[model samples]
Target: MSDFKVFPFETEKQWLKGRMIGIGGSDASAVVGLNPYKSNIELFEEKIGRKIPKDISDKPCVIYGKKAEEYIRELFKLDYPEYQVSHHEYHILQSLEYPFMQASLDGELVDQDGRKGILEIKTTNILQSMQYEKWKDRIPDNYYIQVLHYLLVTGWQFVVLRAHLNTEWGGEKRTTVKHYFIERSDVEDDLKMLLEEEKKFWEYVESGRKPPLILPEI
Candidate 1:
């Protein structure tokens, strides 16, 4: 099991500073060029304090997700009564083995069998068919990378991702809720790969060298 320390912050400013101290789940995808929004070079600049991270808290989608996360996590608890869910207010988990690795979990889980897992809640607005396709039969690639990073940090046994997708079909508004479970055992190789990639990216941050621009395959 990975050893971790909980870092608590009382304000958003403190949280942002805490995040800069290490690589976060959201940053993991960018490290490997899987994140659709951010590039590895951008992440490196942010980590090294060369560039200010964009503040997305004002975005409507971000605002809604923040507000809905608690409700969604609660729903998961009701949906899976056999698993106990717990959360700590404004706390971040930092790995002891890799002090530069961290995770901000939505909720932590303990199953009836006492196996530990992670609960990740996501609220997304899908406006196009392409967006829906990302969730067709599996979780989105970036999200998959994200949960794996969490697994790497916490050494947890599994992760349960609850996604709430809002979309419009036939001119009618609709919502689709789904759960994707990832077991550490099933993706040990992936976790190892992600860790190596993240370690490489952190080296770039520490050395103040920008990573080469990596684009998604066409």
Candidate 2:
């Protein structure tokens, strides 16, 4: 709820370069060793310019998700009419309180009560039964860390994440869309914890010191 800054990028190159300046929502889980795809050491290396982050734009799943994002966001607006939805193209929100904290939101929301919230969209392939179970009663740990990072950066009142899960069963393809809501009031302690962890990670970056590798849970 303090002050923040909005940065606009005109090109993909600029956006990618800017991400190095801070810890982003996607980078949050990696910082805490919760992201299965990326490790804490990798994130640290990327932040310190020891390596360039891989470009996933050409990946099939990445391509599909990018193309589907706009349509899915439209569907969310139609389905959740109680909240006013809006989006800003190619802009990142940076926290003044914690300059190393940033958020690149899919969309934003304002409820009837004038409370502002975040809109996060995800598209993933559910290839196995275990993958589906991760979304059964709760958001996956990585995603929960992501939204919490967004909340920490923007200080939003709530978050609504819409996930589109694609799966194939018996040679038949199907898509299931699920929505989850998170209230900031319910996760104040989590926010505090994430902030502290992120601050420690950023310190390592600023000091040009490598942090100990944090392995993901199996």
Candidate 3:
């Protein structure tokens, strides 16, 4: 089992600052070069407090996603009546064994059998969501990495991803809900590799060294 320490903060701004102190789930994606919007070099600059021109979270899509999180969680509850879903009071968790590893989960879920797992809520435009075949089996790579990071930090056996797809149909707004269950055992090797890469990245952050930028493949 992984040991973790909860760092409770009074405000979102404080939480954001706390995140900079350690690598969180979102940062995990970038560290591993899976995040399309950000690269490892960019993350390195942010961690080292080099003034970045723009905050990705301030982007319109990201802002809308955050705003729709609550509604997405409620949708999950309504769809999965057998499961007990609860929100976490503390948004930040740091691994006691690996201080550089941390997680900020959206919520928690208890199955009908009382098995506990982490909940990750997401919102995306219909076009993006529909680009995939089945969400239950497949999700964007960056999002998958994010969830895996959470599982690694929380020592959870599994994670439930609930996504809301927004679309406009015939002048009317439509929202569709999809959920997926990802087991840690299914991605153990990948997580192990991710941990190693994150350890190296943390070293750069701690040493005030910038990591090499990952160029796009031809």
What TM-score goes with each of the models? 0.96, 0.97, 0.88
**Lowest-sum lDDT 10-residue window in model 2:** 12-21
Q: Model 3's lDDT to the true fold?
A: 0.81
lDDT of 1 by residue, 1-218 (tens): 44798999998788877887889999899999998888888888888888898988899999999999998888888889999999986788999999999999999999888999999999999988899899989999999999999999998899999999998778998889998988889999999899999988888888888889878765
RMSD of each predicted structure: 1.3, 1.1, 2.5
lDDT of 1 at 35: 88
Error of 3 at 6 (Å): 0.7
Q: Candidate 2 — which residues are off by over 4 angstroms?
A: none
Q: For residues 24-117, what per-residue lDDT tens digits would candidate 2 score against the true structure? A: 9999999999998899899999888899888888999999998999999999989999999999877888999998898889999999999999
As for lDDT, the candidate ahead, 2 or 3, is 2
* Number of colliding residue pairs in each model: 0, 0, 0
Positional deviation of residue 134's Cα in model 2 after best superposition, in angstroms: 0.5
Candidate 1 lDDT for residue 122:
90
